[model samples]
Structures are given as C-alpha cells and as structure tokens.
Target: MFKRVIWIGGGVVIGVVIAAKAEAYVRANTPKSAREFVLGTDQDHVAERTLSSLWGQFRTIMDSREEELNRRYIDRARSARH
Candidate 1:
C-alpha cells in the first residue's frame, strides 16, 4: 500500500512538472502579435477591423486597376479607328 502511494505521488508530481514546462514553452514560443490578439481587450474586434481594412484596400486597388484598364482599352480603340 505504501509503495502504491509513493508511485501515485511521483506520477502526480511528474505530470504537474511536465504541464508547467509545456505551458512555459508555449508562452515563450508564442508570437507577440498572436499573444496580443488572444489576450487583448480588443480581441473581439481585431479580426473584424483587420478584415475591413484589408477589404477597403483591396477595393481601392481594384477600382484603380479597373480605371487604368478601361482607359487603356478606350485609347487602343481610338487609335485603331484612325
């Protein structure tokens, strides 16, 4: 019975030590941005804000490209008509 208790206690201690080490390793290796995104108060809106900003930039670029393409096509058609 004493031997069994000692084994159980040793197992519990080892498990705890392993868990702590794992937690520390993860914390140390985690990226700062990821940690901030996870733990920040603005976590809920971070993704939404990021996506919105990205979408806005994409739209702006798309519009600019479309305008350039249309201008080029019109110019080419005009030149061909001459």
Candidate 2:
C-alpha cells in the first residue's frame, strides 16, 4: 500500500511537470493572437506571457503576504508573553 501510494504520487508529480513544460513551450512558440484566442482572455497584454511569468508574480505576492503574516504572528506572540 505504501509503495503503491508512492508510485501514484510520483506519477502525478511527473505528469504535472510534463504538462507544465509543454504548456510553457506552447506559450513561448505560439503567436499572441492565437494564444489569446485559445485562452479567451480579453487582455491583450498577457497574450505574450508564459505560465512562469504569472507564477513568478503570484509567488511574489504570496511571499509578501507570508512575511506580513509572520510579522503579525511574532508581534502577537511577543505581546502575549509580556
């Protein structure tokens, strides 16, 4: 059971990575208008961007939020200790 679970989890990770790489390749090679048509997005600006770009932006926002949350938690902990 444990080995089966590990195999399934590994397969899922590999599949997701392959899919992401394929998507990045398509996003890079496809024309802007074609990509926009496929994505059905009204924004003309994002037509040229790849998943990596969007992921970077998302990661930045998440990191900032995490830092803010950590700061708040530390402050609360210190207050409680006093």
Candidate 3:
C-alpha cells in the first residue's frame, strides 16, 4: 500500500512537471492565445491555461495561508499547554 501510494504520488509529480513545461512552451510559442486567455478575454481561457499553472498558482497562494494557519495553531496550542 505504501509503495503504491509512492508510485501514484510520483506519477502525479511527473505529470505536473510535464504539463507545466508544456504550458510554458505553449505560452512561449502562442502568447497571444495563452496570455490573453489568462485575463477575462474569453470564458474558455479559464480552462485553457494548463492545470500546472493553475496548480502552481494555487500552491503558492495556499502555502502562505497554510503557514499563517500553522502559526496560529501553534500559538494556540502552546497557550493551551500552559
């Protein structure tokens, strides 16, 4: 079970890297289409910007939020322990 979990997780990481590289490639080759879509130019633009970019953006946003929540949680936990 543990091995399978690692295998699946590794596969997911590999897929994300390939997709991000692909997205960066497409953005380089097709900036007008890829770049324009990031804005509110078209509804489909929301879907066109590869999952990796979206995930990368979300991961960045969430990491900050997670750190904040962790700090608060630790502060509360430490206070309660006293």
Candidate 4:
C-alpha cells in the first residue's frame, strides 16, 4: 500500500517535470509569428508579398498565352474604371 502510493506520487512528479521540459523546449524552438520564420521577419507589406508569391506560383501552372490573357483581363478591368 505505501509502496504503491510512493510510485503514484513519483509518476505524477515525473510527468510534471517532463511536461515542463517539453513546453520549454517548444517555446525555445518555435517562432512567435509565422511571418518571422517564413517570408521574412519584417511585418510591413506582408499581405502584398504573400499574395504575390502565391499568385506567382499559381501563375506558373498556366501557359504563356493564358498568363497574357489573365494580365490583359486584369489590366482592362483596371482601365475600364478610368
């Protein structure tokens, strides 16, 4: 009975210690913000760069003529407002 109690108490303490260590390890390793680790550390103009990077990568799937068509459509839409 006494030995079982000691074992349970020791197990709980060990578990707590392991959790604290793991949390510390993760805090030390992981960045607070994703942008700091991925695109850049700077926060300025992130949305534009993020959109451009994704759109540029997606544009690679289309052929040259398709890309030109897309550009013309986008430009015409912009020009139509003037």
By lDDT, the best candidate is 2
lDDT of 3 by residue, 3-49 (tens): 99999999999987886676566667765865665544553454465
Candidates sorted on TM-score, descending: 1, 2, 3, 4
TM-score of each: 0.50, 0.45, 0.41, 0.39
Greater lDDT among 3 and 4 belongs to 3
- The TM-score that candidate 4 achieves is 0.39
lDDT of 2 by residue, 39-65 (tens): 556444442565568789999999999
Error of 1 at 59 (Å): 0.5
Q: Put down candidate 4 lDDT per residue, 1-82, tens digits, no spaces.
A: 9999999999989986885675456557777674356436654555577669879987786667798999999999999999
Weakest ten-residue segment in model 3 by summed lDDT: 38-47
Q: Could you list the CA RMSD of all candidates, in the order they appear?
A: 18.8, 7.0, 7.9, 19.2
Q: Which ten residues in a row have the lowest lDDT in candidate 1?
A: 38-47
How would you encode candidate 1's per-residue C-alpha lDDT over 51-82 as one tens digit per residue? 68889999999999999999999999999999
Quickly count the clashes in candidate 4. Answer: 0
State each model's CA lDDT, in order.
Answer: 0.77, 0.78, 0.75, 0.73
Candidate 1 residue spans exceeding 4 A from truth: 1-41
